[model samples]
Target: MDKFKKIDVEQLNIVDENGTVRLKLFNNQNIPPAIIDGEDILPGHRQSDPIAGMMFYNTEGDETGGLIYGSKKDEDGNYTTSGSLTFDQYKQDQVVQMEHNEENGKKNYGFSIYDRPNTNLREDIIKDKEIRDSKKSENEKIQELNKLWEGNVRRAFMGKNGDGDVIVQLSDSKGEPRIRMVVDQYDTPRMEFLDGEGNVLYKLPPEE
Candidate 1:
């Protein structure tokens, strides 16, 4: 397809909403045809090899999407790899390390996902206290503001830092009427509410 090389975890896109996760797999390399061995590679590959370098997008919470590298099986094909990489042993060889970026305000949280077999790494995100605290605080503030509106509201992004502000976005119940709420270092938000046409509706008073 593109140029064959080690997987770039950044390019993979996974969007998940509710309990359903939408996974779109596109490789720069032509998926290696099929590994040979006695290999019904596709079938066995899906069961054993961990889908390497995957990005996760969690629409529901903090554990949205990121790069997946390590040992994993498509036991139920939740990831849709059954037809591509089929067996367990093939999956073993497929394991890889992945890098992920979690957006926070104007900054991003960067980390890696490692293969468990022979790859020892910390599994929890909280290991980075500063990043974890920022995400949690950001989520809470956004949730509070979400309850103020009657329509659909969402936290568009959360990054490490920038202009010393935290940004939260709101959309209509059906996800329109886009608005941005930027929280300052003191946790006060300077509001910029806009309509579907991107027109500013009005600005609210800063939080005291």
Candidate 2:
């Protein structure tokens, strides 16, 4: 085995015996595009900003999930930082994730579990892009996109919000929060149950 005191590299790939890329480590400029079912789909899905991170691939080379983090200070001296570690659900999107996001001096961090449809996420993304590029009006596009992405639901989240409250929220299938337990910034603890329409039905302590 060869050893080096230090190695400088922008990107690296770890492959299996059959030469399939099982994992990839990369810099912002070297990050690979999203790969699904052996096809490279939306290249611009990550948006215009550059992020450095690593990607995880399954046995068939499909991207399952990965960890990514980036921080930047703008010309106006404002700071933005974000990081996430996620695990995908088969051919779908993230089923579980831990994330942190901060901008200026505000911060939010949480762990979440999502419920996604069995449909192919790659296909949905491509169709969404097509709809956005078509001649449809904004309302029509929004309606179609809403129907298309309705199956993606966040089922649970436990995190500290930007307001400094620590919260554990659970939602229904339609992504409506049904229960919330929180510790406010002032150290007040409260638990509430809500109806489907988000009206608080009950609280731990009876109000005056």
Candidate 3:
């Protein structure tokens, strides 16, 4: 045993015996990219990167998830910040996450789970994102994806919403909020049952 000493470091990476970066801690100026399957999918873009966080890698060097935080105030006097710890599905987007965010004077905190798709569905998602970002109307493309999204990656979340209300939301495969429960800042508890189209069909207290 030896006497402990203080250590100062802006970034640190813990690697496996094979030299795979299984864990990394970095500052905003040196944010690291996501590594997947021993390859970097999205890397830091120099000063443009706003994240100050640690990334976690899988045994194969793929990006399983990360914890990140960034905050800044623009010249216009608006403050923005967000922090999240996320877990990714194999070969897909985030499947679980704990997040807290604030923007435009609103704040949200919660945990969520996202269903993942198979290989074929993953390709569809990639294509759709590209189309959504193109200089074209996304209506048709959104509808197209909607048609294919049935029974795909659904989502559910429980959190305290921006208005300081506790909320639980469950979405259908089409990404429609089908069920919801809320406890507002005033401690009023309410529940809503919705149809497939997200139209509320009933309320726990029954509407007047």
Largest TM-score belongs to which candidate?
2
Q: Considering only N, C-alpha and C atoms within 3 Å, which residue pairs clash in candidate 3?
A: 36-62, 37-62
Computed on alpha carbons, the lDDT of every model, listed in order, comes to 0.38, 0.92, 0.79
Q: lDDT per residue, candidate 1, 91-128, as tens digits?
A: 22222222222222233322212222321112111233
Error of 3 at 89 (Å): 1.1
| Residue runs of model 2 more than 4 Å from their true location after superposition | 129-144
Q: List the residue pairs that clash in candidate 2.
A: none
lDDT per residue, candidate 3, 24-128, as tens digits? 899986777655544445444334747788888877777778899988888999988899999887765688999989998899989999886654434555576
Report the alpha-carbon TM-score of model 3 versus the true structure: 0.80
Error of 3 at 138 (Å): 7.5
Off by over 4 Å in 3: 1-4, 43-47, 120-154
Which rank order by lDDT, best down to worst?
2, 3, 1
- Name the top lDDT candidate: 2
Clash number for candidate 1: 28
* Residues 99-196, model 2: lDDT tens digits: 99999989999999999998897898889999999999999999999999997999999999999999999999999999999999999999999999
Worst 10 residues of 3 by lDDT: 37-46
TM-score for candidate 2: 0.91
